[model samples]
Target chain A: EAGVVQSPRYKIIEKKQPVAFWCNPISGHNTLYWYRQNLGQGPELLIRYENEEAVDDSQLPKDRFSAERLKGVDSTLKIQPAELGDSAVYLCASSSWDGYSGANVLTFGAGSRLTVL
Target chain B: AQTVTQSQPEMSVQEAETVTLSCTYDTSESDYYLFWYKQPPSRQMILVIRQEAYKQQNATENRFSVNFQKAAKSFSLKISDSQLGDAAMYFCALGEYGNKLVFGAGTILRVKS
Candidate 1:
């Protein structure tokens, strides 16, 4: 079984430029998530998708950050006009199901390291 | 709102020895899941162990185990006979019905020879 896959393992961009990260979750997984992790800090959820529908995006920065999970198999997180503070690791994870049971285990990708100059 | 806290920013232990990393959380909900993830230099989040809120026996996986104190809202990871390969950043995370995770600041473990 293949694990979660992410592209552009590392990215570098200027402060005012636009950057996007992509994620392809494990096969048959129904839930997908996007998280941001700063140096020395754990990951914080930015958005969640349940089969192509964004069910939670309260933590996403509406002004500069946007995400989409079209078809629910893959996801993209975009940050336009990036800021220096946006330099961090963007991680994507997926789970098989929700609620009780199903092991509820999350398989995470290697993450895309975004460095905003 | 739910929050997870990792009191120790860093910890070190001699090879073959034991070390424990502390974690605490605040939540009003009764049903949830707690997880310990180890991220090495490779940056992959590896699931070391997990515990369900309703379980009392605790969760153990080989050299890794969790001490889950439900009343105190504390979940600590104990690594027995630590190895150099265990050097990594360990994160404590919480999740409910929707698969949304709330993570703590994380603890860095250094294994000494």
Candidate 2:
């Protein structure tokens, strides 16, 4: 039983550059999520995907942030022309959609730390 | 809109002692889920414990337990016989079916010898 997997555990980029983070959810999980966490703060959801379709993405900065869950198994979060304030840890999580029965315990990845200078 | 609040920014307790972290959330939904996640230096979010809104009994896991007050919308985590390994940033979150989570500002716990 492998947990959620993320790549580039650490990333460093300059402001105005483009950066992307990747996530591979647990096998058979139907729901995926992307979250951002700033220093001293909790993780905030940027987007959510039910399978391959994005069900919620209101918190994402559409101007500079874009996300895709092509096959729903793996997802990508991108931030182009990044800003200094964008420096934070990007976390990905997944859960079964049986939330109604209280089966939505999320399993999270180690997260990708993005440092925008 | 639902919101979660963690009043304590940081807390410390000696090993083998007990400590409680406070959290409060606002939500209109009658049925929801509350969670306590621990993020250590490794940066992985680990579920410490969770409580369902409809459940009256508090949720307990190993040495971690929660005090859920539905009427007051308060959820607090109590770590019994705390260990140095318990040091981490603890986040309180609220979510309902098909809805995104609303998280608190988080409380950092420091376990001292």
Best by DockQ: 2
Span of ten consecutive residues with least summed lDDT in model 2 chain B:
B94-103
CA lDDT, candidate 2, residue A107: 90
Pairs that collide, model 1: none
lDDT of 2 at B27: 93
The local distance difference test score of each candidate is 0.91, 0.92
Per-prediction CA RMSD (Å): 1.3, 1.2
Interface quality of candidate 2 as DockQ = 0.75
Q: What local lDDT score does residue A114 receive in model 1, on the 0 to 100 scale?
A: 93
In lDDT terms, how accurate is model 2? 0.92
Q: For every model in order, what is the iRMS? A: 1.5, 1.4
lDDT of 1 by residue, B1-113 (tens): 89999999999999999999999998888988899999997678998998989789999999999999999999999999999999999999988755578999999999999
Give the true-contact fraction for every prediction, in order.
0.71, 0.74
